[model samples]
Target: MLNKTRGRPRGNPDTKARIAEAARELFLERGYKGTTVRAVAAEAGVDSALISYHFGSKQRLFGQSLNLLCVESTALDQALQGDQAGLADRLLTSVTSLWDATAPTENRMALQDDDTMRAFRDYLESELLVRVAEFLGGPDATERATAAVGVIGGLIFTRSLNPIRSIAALPSAEVRRIFGPALRAALHARARQH
Candidate 1:
């Protein structure tokens, strides 16, 4: 006769997946600041310790849930390299294509709440805009980078989510052609010392 040990059951590979799925759903529903590890654990039917064990932290869990493991940084880095003249075109191509290919669910998460939007903006600034500004390297670099990112972001939001008729009707190549010059101008804005 063996005595029964009472404790939480051992976690299987499936538990991680379940936790991730739960995290994604909660993140989409409640946004980043609103969602907690305890909530995710509840949603996943697991203990909070399991979340810590599996993902280490809420931020890590969020990253896994969103599948955004340095995607923006990598994309921006690639777009920023080689041929400064074509920077706008390359950025438009890379960034638009990326968002266009992204799942609707993930995109919806960005639109969920103020917290989510702030988180998204913060992530974008840290990952892409700030990097672009650093790459440009000038007194006007930050503003120029912001303008460039705004143009790209507006295009993505309009084309992908909101769908403005004029912008939506244009083919990808035409969109790139029409917007490239403005973006290039913004990026090439002259540096000034005040």
Candidate 2:
């Protein structure tokens, strides 16, 4: 025999998504540090334990919310999988392809908003910076990583803004060919001491 006690239900089928949506909204509203698991759970109308059960931790939840645009991006992961050699070309190509595929349907307008952009930039700096620094693996890894992120961010910004018609018209291959070496230079530049 089993005994079950419930008022409404133990869990909602949409609980995970609700939690994610709440976290995303809170993160956009308050930034990472300002948002807490308890707050997210409250916003989602679930228990804090559910958040931990779903996402493990606040950092992981933030990462998942931040990645809503990119999703899994297996291509990007594959590009970063192995040798550092030709990493710039692989990374640039992967990222450009991903953006090109999603640009038309995705809400590019969200990026135009100041608050959204700031939140995204903060997420990128916190998440990508460390990953890139580790991937570069050298005495000046941090500096090179920062430069690489800047170069990539600049490229994305210009493409998004589309200030130049010709530049915008260029195919992904051409764009990759042109920017890959520049990215390489940014990532591989001689370490400068500060």
Q: What are the Cα lDDT values of the candidates?
A: 0.72, 0.71
Tell me the number of clashing residue pairs for each predicted model: 0, 0
Error at 185, model 1, angstroms? 0.8
Which ranges in model 1 have alpha carbons more than 4 Å from their true place? 1-11, 14-64, 67-73, 99-110, 192-194
| Model 1 lDDT tens row, 57-157 | 77567767766432354456678898767889889887666655666446654555554455555555654687788878867889999988888777766
Cand. 1 Cα-lDDT: 0.72
Give the TM-scores of the predictions, in the order they appear.
Answer: 0.62, 0.73
Mark the regions of model 2 whose C-alpha exceeds 4 Å error after superposition: 1-13, 32-42, 45-76, 105-107, 161-163
Our model 2 lands, by Cα RMSD against the true structure, at 4.6
